[model samples]
Target: MASHSLSAVRKRRRRRAKTLLVMVGLLLLTGAGGYLALLNLEPSEAVMRERCTAVVGTETYDLNPDQASNAALIAGVALRRGLPPRAASIAIATAIQESGLRNLDYGDDAGPDSRGLFQQRPSQGWGTQAQVMDPIYAANAFYDGLLKVPGYTNMPITEAAQAVQISAFPEAYADHEPEARAFASALTGYSAASLDCMLRSAESPGDPSQVAAAAAAVFGNQSVVVNESTVTLQAVDRAGWATAQWAVANAKQLNLTSVSFGGLQWDRVGGWTSAETEPGTVTLNVAGAVVE
Candidate 1:
């Protein structure tokens, strides 16, 4: 009777052991399946974070796509006017302090009629309300004010910005000097390959005509050629680098796949890399377009 009882006990123990192993295997399978599902459903954190950066020397400054776009436009205007990089730095600094590089349609209590990038007031002879709200007009208007300042380039950033803006907070412009200078240098073609944009895949097809128009708006009449999905501009040396970096800065909005110039190429997935291309030309390829 004792031997029979011991045999029954051993059988029960073996069944429990098998059940435990089965549960463990099932749990492992479920965990693996969940992981795969997560991978398919969501993008990694790194991939989702989109930003543009300007690395100057040992310091790096960052801006979101919107800010970068505005900064690029501001710098482009300076380039078109043949202003030095210092002028761009001061203009950008004023924009930073005034509207945070964004084109605002509203204004604060001090300047109730203020609008646009430099917070220029329509009442103060900056321009009409509609004109100040237009970024291109606003940028030109800001530069108009800036040019009136005697020896603006020789003045400190705060003093220069204050002279143009005539803001109540004069000292505040100094705070953005470093950031403004970095972006101005990169966008003005003084710093080569110093700007990079990490962005997600383009959401829609890009229009070549739009790209051509934007280039014309900022850089003025350029030798722009459009062939299928590619737009090539005749730019070289510092201007070439400037055009290339500007394309990178505006890539997110333009839905550009790649910008190549001066023996360097930039893409959304892999920042800037080396590639051989014709000299004295900057090539921009728009996204979601068939190359014919």
Candidate 2:
């Protein structure tokens, strides 16, 4: 009887092992099917590859969407304050060195209380922790410090940045000078059609009012025409390009489908191409709507 019971237990264990093997096989097959489905995804369902580039002369600088957005805000603030492109360059370099143009919520050992894009420390009277974490406030504060530095516009990018930042590794700012200058030149409208963002298709319809409000926040009140899914900012010359490029830098967050100015159009897939857009207007179109 004991021998028969032991044999029964062994048979039951073998059946369980067989069941586990079948389950593992099914899991592997399911995983492969999912991968195959991903491989055959439609163009409309392609994964997002979002990035922006600033190309000026022989130099080209690439920034991920978040960094590009922050860089745009910094340059826009400089434009609003009537500061020169040099000021934007200095500010961009400093931000790149200190925070890689990201609005960080924490700090390193050098500035245990630092926050935001420029890493302004609350302990040093930059602002309250909440205020320092605000990108707009942080950018304005950095510009305020830059403006206080006499002859900053004429100083080398590193020196100008160091004068305002007083960073421990002052020389690090110089390393980002080329990248900063390229972005500044394109964003400031000194180089037309020099900034482009390659992004995935917009996920949903975008709000034109929000775009207009953001543009106004950066470039001040302007002649704006709003349609179903488009907003035309009546700015000409370099200013038009500045507004257009600013829209491009912000395209990811704004869900912008296209930005056209000075007879050039930048769309999500086609990049920059010649268009019939008027020279004196910067027209922005959002996704999933008719654009007039």
Best by lDDT: 1
User: Which portions of model 2 show Cα errors greater than 4 Å?
Assistant: 1-48, 289-292
Worst 10 residues of 1 by lDDT: 38-47
Estimate, for each residue in 1-292, the C-alpha lDDT of model 1 and write its tens digit: 9999999999999999999999999998788668645443234432477889998899999998899999999999999999999998998888888898999999965488989888888888888999999998888888888899999889999998888787899999999999999999999999999999988667677998899888888999999998778899999899998898889999989989899998889998647899998899999999873322
Cand. 1 Cα-lDDT: 0.88
How far in Å is the alpha carbon of 289 misplaced in model 1? 5.4
lDDT of each: 0.88, 0.86
- For every model shown, the clashing-pair count is 0, 0
TM-score for candidate 2, residues paired by index: 0.84
Please give the RMSD of candidate 1 to the true structure.
6.5
lDDT of 2 by residue, 2-45 (tens): 99999999999999999999999999878866764644433444
